[model samples]
Target: MDYESLYKLIPKEPKKWLTQDVISWLQFIGLGQMEQKFVECSIDGAVLEDLTEKDLDEELGITQRIIKRKLLNWVNHGLKEYNEYIKQMKMPNLNNKKQQDEDFTIQKNIANSQFEQMLIENHENNGNDQFTSSVVRQEEQAIKQEIPGFNKFEHQLILQPIEGQQSNFYCVREAGAKIGRHSSNQILILEENISRFHAEIIFQDSMFALKDIGSTTGTFIKILKSLTLIQGMLIELGSNQFSVQKLDLLDNGGIEISLFVVEGPNLEDTIIFQLNKDKPSVALGRKSTVDISFPEDHHLSNQHAKFYLVDQTVTIEDHGSTNGSWMRLSGEGKMSNLFYLDPNEEIIIRIGTTNQYICQQNKMKVNEISGENLCIICVERERDCLILPCKHNATCLKCSKNLALCPFCRVKIQETIRIYKN
Candidate 1:
């Protein structure tokens, strides 16, 4: 009647572990339903009749042999995966130069196929060929991309106030988040106070913008890390959505602040959305979602490629971290270790040391934005210019002074190169 040992046998960390117990549990009871009941029953104990294997197979109309085989296969696979995880943990720390190289080789060999599958999936979702017609737009907007290790979901804030208690809610962009205004570094303005409020914010997909609505006491804005205030007056994000702030008018009025949680899709989902907009098919960097029937090991290291479709042109930039990123333009086979990317261009990101793990990317045309030929970066209009170091393109005078890098690709430049047209 003691299932504690069986539960303890399940590894704490199983990134690559199989879900045999989960499957068996599902068969005995049901998914999402009766989970607590089954856990209680398992604690008391599980009976063959209580397992519901036959009934489940009948409901699913599956043969008894298939269910039994699948269950057995999952158990075996789970054991193997758990053992591998243990083996990895027991290995010596790979830190020294030589050890690092060896670790990179080993890890890459193990993680390569998964990486390549991600790339292939990315390419299938978004290909570079789609950008053949559109010129790169100078006007800037926030877009999302699938970054590894980072959370790719949106978060919202929910505020609740206790009745008759007064509470104040102050909302600003988190620390480390950059802020800019009309080509100038400015502070965000706040609307006066209110009693209760709720607002939504997001950081995934490379977007770097925020908005505040009219509130009772007013909301203040500042950069995430620095004390630098964003320039200009306060502006709400969307036409319809309003920023919120709370003010205590009477007694016992306080609010509970909660964040909106957007659950991420399974690794099997090829295209990950950064915002609430339409999404394109994107390839995985080093992982792919295959038909569940096929073993995951089959497509592990071979498919590490990616691609995305955008309104005008696509851009890629190196994050200026430890490992250097590389690219293969148009499948040329020769990889270039440089920064920045454009439409129709294919790239491979060399992550970590020695470039053992590579993430490839291409462009696709399915979700093309309207107005491919329209170029927004010019000197004439009331355009906002983003300044950079090398001075490749001359952006609007307003836009240039506010940015520290080329807004198109975020490439850092040394000098403030300002080239205006006559």
Candidate 2:
């Protein structure tokens, strides 16, 4: 679950929350790693509401002073909000007073609540339309308030004109939405590259999740933490994409996978690693020292993410990146993607401009890398030339002199830059 999703759930009230809800809240406060202790202590929502800072160290065994303070602050702030909400909730005095405004803002806030209320009322009043038009208008006046640019059709695909495409922001809906290029779809894109029924984003249990239908281009999302690694599957780090170049069996019965820089600037120089029991991980980022680097792709952090080759399994994890790392998702079988939107950030289901990349992998005249840090052509000498425009460095100065295409991403080499390193 995305941490911010928990904030939307605060409307459910703390006392009525379950164990998973408490766990979700822990992630919201960035203390999800220590939740086993919370589970061991059987700290449900009711108990969590009363938990004080002292109880963290004394009862939950969270010894780190800073962590305890952070958790304490989150708990206290949340309780304060809940308490204030309860105090303001006025119950009608048995027909002796006017009906109160339901204190809805105290819960999901007026924006989210009213939107949902409109949907629910629309659905409920479908057949039985007894209310007058004036009554409906009056009801809207009392409850309807839209945040400007807020409800610009969360999932509806706007007609795109020729030129370039822009980012699509979706509204969190109770009815959920179907996304695709089909004219009949709830969310539609005109890109011919996108499949007719590309994917679906559903809202369940007060959170949103994305699932691929049967799209050809595929849906991809960044790894917030870990993913069961698969060979051939593409991983998007920033402006580029990658896949398995080589997979080797380790002495410890685990497996090591070397990533093929499919499309991007190679800043790490090489993306080769020996993953034995001693080194069960491979790191990737824009930092030169990273196992696989794309130094020019500022969207990445020093260490964007990691690939863990365990004894029986392989997994990938996000190492606190700026733009985040992504993994391509396969079409419908399992839920595939559970998107817990952080109410703090915009919710984007990025199918991208599908047609532009539909033939990307197929058309690549791949000059696959021989090993990490080696020349793209000779596979022996150091790759030392920085191809201009793309900022890619995958070919040795000797090999790149006559090269027309930058070996990493196949972008035409316009100019060359070579800095000798001792």
Candidate 3:
């Protein structure tokens, strides 16, 4: 039969019927296996009034002869059932309607009674005003309690890359934050040198502190000098003995004492320094007073290069060294003679033929190092000093003294004691 003839055979209600109803009719007609194909046809709008038998045959993947005969029988049966249902809905018995109205009213009264009972129970529970007031007061007191050192403004950890002129800032929002290669950690370091769960920055006892969580490489902070204001003057008694008893008064009132002079490494040495907020700028070369001195190298100038932090960005600029300074960026196999670094990248500093330093935002784990004996900074010198706080024995005495921060964890080194073999 044609689509127009088949469509006219179906009742309007059956045309609006669901897929399940169509499936039921298909099963009743002994065509249950073909139900899925018919449902697909319906989804493609094949059940519409404009649908043709040719369209159904192509969509249902069934022959026109079989489908036409099956659909005609299904439609005839559905039309009879649809007409009877419509007639019953339109002419419901008056006796049944009255009975339904009465049943609805009774249900409404029962619901009202249940609602009133719930209200009475709620009122009884709230009658204990004293208990409620005490609970509210306790909550208020807890809110007012002061927590020391948790000044939101100061509680921030910044990871500044030594090579690249980029930094990552993390707000101390929670009690602690984990930093590592693990996906679960708040701060992720994807470098293979970092452990899965490397370290944690915790806010405890009103202080934001960094702790190394048994990482292969340790954590480090930049060492800063503790500044103290002294009111008294100093007297030069003997070489090592300074007698504060003999007060030397100045014209301005009290004389300030200069107990010791903190000097940079000697010119002939290779120094490793960490870039931090307080001391951001560092000069490297043959000068003894340079932040990072390379005194013995003739290829280096009096001031070879400068590594400084500008607004949290670490940048290195060559200062006219005779042999010239070069940098190799992260992931690069060969060292390039690049003058500047890209963002979020690591660079190896090379002066002459020696790889002077590896500049990066984060420290590499000890296990990530190919050799244990080599210094972490120079990579050429034998390691002899064990950095304190995060005890990773990774640098020689010369490199350790010059380092304000540990190369492994980037944490400030409190002290670096020399380790001697017996």
Q: What TM-score quantifies how close candidate 2 is to the native fold?
A: 0.40
Better of 1 and 3 by TM-score: 3
Question: What is candidate 3's lDDT per residue for 27-94, written digit by digit as tens?
Answer: 55567787777664432111432345565576556775876766654455545455566555456476
> Candidate 3 has what TM-score?
0.22
Model 2 C-alpha lDDT versus the unseen true structure: 0.56
Q: Which stretches of candidate 2 lie over 4 Å from their true place?
A: 1-177, 190-197, 200-217, 264-270, 330-349, 353-422
The RMSD (Cα, Å) of candidate 1 is: 26.4
TM-score of each: 0.18, 0.40, 0.22
Q: Which candidate is the best by lDDT?
A: 2
Regions more than 4 Å wrong, model 1: 1-60, 64-67, 76-80, 83-92, 95-422
- For model 2, state the Cα shift of residue 133 in Å: 21
Error of 3 at 260 (Å): 23
Q: What lDDT score goes with residue 154 in model 2?
A: 20
Q: Encode model 2's per-residue lDDT on 270-310: one tens digit a residue.
A: 35566666777888777999887777887777787787866
* lDDT of candidates 1 onward, in order: 0.27, 0.56, 0.43
Could you give candidate 1's per-residue lDDT for residues 315-420 as a string of tens digits? 1222111111222111112222222222122212211111121111111111123221112232234322223222233244554564465533345543343221
Instruction: Report the lDDT of model 1 for residue 210.
Output: 29
